[model samples]
Target: MPRFGGPEVLELDRHHPDPVPGPDQVVVRVHAASLNHLDLAVREGIPTLKLTLPHILGCDAAGDIAEVGSDVTDVEVGDRVVVNPGVSCGRCEYCLRGEDSECVEYKILGEHLPGTYAEKVAVPARNVLKIPTDMDFPQAAAVPLAFMTAWRMLITRAKVRPGEDVLILGAGSGVSTAAIQVAKLAGCTVFTTSSSDAKLEKAKALGADVLVNYKAMPWSKAIWELTGKRGVDVVVDHVGEATFKDSVRSLRKGGRVVVPGATTGALLELDARYLFWRQLSVLGSTMANQREFEEVMKLVFMGRLKPVVDRVFPLEQARQAHEYLGRGEQFGKVVLAIDTPD
Candidate 1:
């Protein structure tokens, strides 16, 4: 986007510079890239995140390796791969400990750096993971940020286990869709809320054990009654201020609430009494580290978990795609298909 504003700000830049890889990076000829709420936030401008104008906005992508730097040995040209969006200073203590998301200089693709909206993007060698030949570009593109963030939030931060009940607020989002599958795969009974019944049905197909139409009734009350008044063990809440208090209300004593992103608004209101009396744990997570990224991708490759792509738009139609995503109607990930050279 030339300047942060609305979907109208997104313009096709035919003359945008092609990326060149650093000594330890690789240039990927992007075939597909997925949209996230982060894209919308960055496009509209986040007060704290100052960007160099004319920034590219896309986080998750999959493509063929167009060029490899001298120091890149594992991946070769023409390899099918997915890019891990999280970039960290490898020298940081958090990075050394495999907690790259906690690194002091942690940055995300399209957020702190140039992103994959273009035909070519340069990413760190360590951030490139080869995808199975069976996985198509758009499917691979939809996996990274959403699945990685969900994996870290549920598996790493929340430590959700079998038989535990998980309440994932907002069933239509990319991360929430992935979280439903992850929770199911972990043997948890999943409860999800959506305003649309059609979306609730789709969430059920993804292994959601209980579905609540938040539009029909109060979701927290529904969850309370559904769980027989015991409440859920974990609440995965990304819709922040709009539902954060209700998310807290939906949790049982000592239950955990994991937040990966706040799509609605950040400043939340919650009853401090519930936190102190119930001894609830609130955990904040971002994109996964290298190991966590690979772990979740392996599941994706194995078909144990799958990405839900709601719609696909050609690269030139990014403004339309952004507008569609902004309407908040997509049931899953919205993707942009990039036309690569022959």
Candidate 2:
């Protein structure tokens, strides 16, 4: 964006210089890129994040390798691949332990670096993974950030298991859409909340065992009553101040609340008694590590898990896509299809 503000600040720059690959990076000709709430936050200006002018905004991308760094040999030009948005210094202690998200220099595509909204983007060589032959660019692009975040949150941080109840707040968001599937794949009975009954029905179709329209009644009370007053075993709550307290109330004793990102508002308030007395756990998770990424992508490739693409827009209509996403109307990922460069 030229300057951070509303979606109108987004402009199409066809003549922008193509990116050059670093020694350990590869330049990808992005075929498809997907939107995330992070993009909107970055465009509007995050209080803690500083960005250079005219920064691109997209985290997940699927494309072909246009060029590889001199030292790279595992992949070649024209290879179809998906980009892992998380970038970290390999030498860090966290990276050595395979926790790249906790690396000292960890950064995400479209956040701390140039992103994949254009025809070409440069990413680390190790960050590119081959996609299944059957998967389209838009489907592949929708997988990385959303699936990985949900995977790490449920499988790694929360450690959810079979026969448990997982309450995922917000049925229509990209992460929530992915979380419902992930929680189901883990054999958990999923409960999700949305203001719209239509979205609740869609969430139900995604393996949600119980759907509550928050507009119809209080969600926490609904969940509490639905689970026979015992509460859920895990709560996936990224809706910060708006729902955190209720999420706490909806969890069972010794339950876990896994948070990936907060979309509503950050500052949260809750009763401490519920936390300590119930031995509740609130875990924060970011994008997955390489191992977790591969694991979840394997499920995606195997057809056990699927990426939901709500709509497709041409690259030039990014402003419209942003507006659509900002309105919270999409049931899944909104993708931007990039035109092939001549």
Candidate 3:
């Protein structure tokens, strides 16, 4: 976007020059780019994210390798791949410890650097993973950010176990779409809330055992009653101030609430008594570490997990795509097609 404000600020620069790879980087001929709530946040100029004006906005991408750096050897040109958007200095202690998200200089694709909203983008060679020929570019693009973040939140931070009661808030989001499936595959009885009944129904097909329309009724109370007043074991909430307190309230004693992003304002107040008396764990998470990314993408490649893409738009219509997402009408992800195959 030219300047942070709204979707109107986004400009389609079709004449923008393609990127050149560094010695450790590779140039990708981008086919598809997926939108995240993060894209909207960065566009609006979050105070903490300090992005340069006229930022390119897209965190998840998939395409073919167009050029390889001299030092790159693992993959060659013409390889179909998905890019891992998280970037960290490989020399950092956190990266060495497999906690790349905590690196002193952690950067995400599009957020901290030039992003995937172009015909081509340059990313570190290690960031691209080859995808099976059967997976199309738009589908591959939908996998990176949402799946990686959800994997870390559920498996790494929440440590969700089999037969647990897990609640996923905002079933319409990309992360929640991935979270519901991940929880189900882990054998959890999932509960999810959405304002739209159609979205909730889709969540059911994704293995959500309880679907609550938060618009029609208070979701926490409904979940509490559904679980026989015992509450659930884990609550996945990224909605922030709008649902943070209710998310905490829906958890059972010693239960945890995991968050990847806060789409709503972040300054939500929490009562210390709720934390102390209930022994609840509220964990904050961002994009995944490399280890988590690889592990999760393996499942995505194996077709054991799937990405839900709500709509597709051509690159020139990126501003309209962002506005569509901002309206919260999409049931899952909104992807932009850059170099779609003939």
lDDT of each: 0.94, 0.93, 0.90
Ranking by TM-score: 1, 2, 3
Alpha-carbon runs more than 4 Å astray in model 2:
none
TM-score of 1: 0.99
On lDDT, the leading prediction is 1
Tens digit per residue, CA lDDT, model 3, 151-216 = 999999999999999999999999999999999999999999998999999999888999999888
Q: How many backbone clashes does candidate 3 have?
A: 0
Instruction: Please write out the lDDT profile of model 2 over residues 256-316, one tens digit for every residue.
Output: 9887888899987777888899999989999999999999998999999989999999999
Candidate 1, superposed: residue stretches over 4 Å from native: none
Compute the lDDT for candidate 1. 0.94
- How far residue 85's Cα lies from its native spot in candidate 3, in Å, is 0.2
Which pairs clash (backbone N, Cα, C closer than 3 Å) in model 2?
A: none
For candidate 1, write residues 1-342 as lDDT tens digits: 889898999999988888989999999999999999999999999999988999999999999999999998999999999999999999988989989999999999999999989899999999999999889999999999999999999999999999999999999999999999999999999999999999999999999999999888899999999999999999999999888999999899999999887888999887888899999999999998889999999999999999999999999999999999999999989999999776
Q: For candidate 3, give the lDDT.
A: 0.90
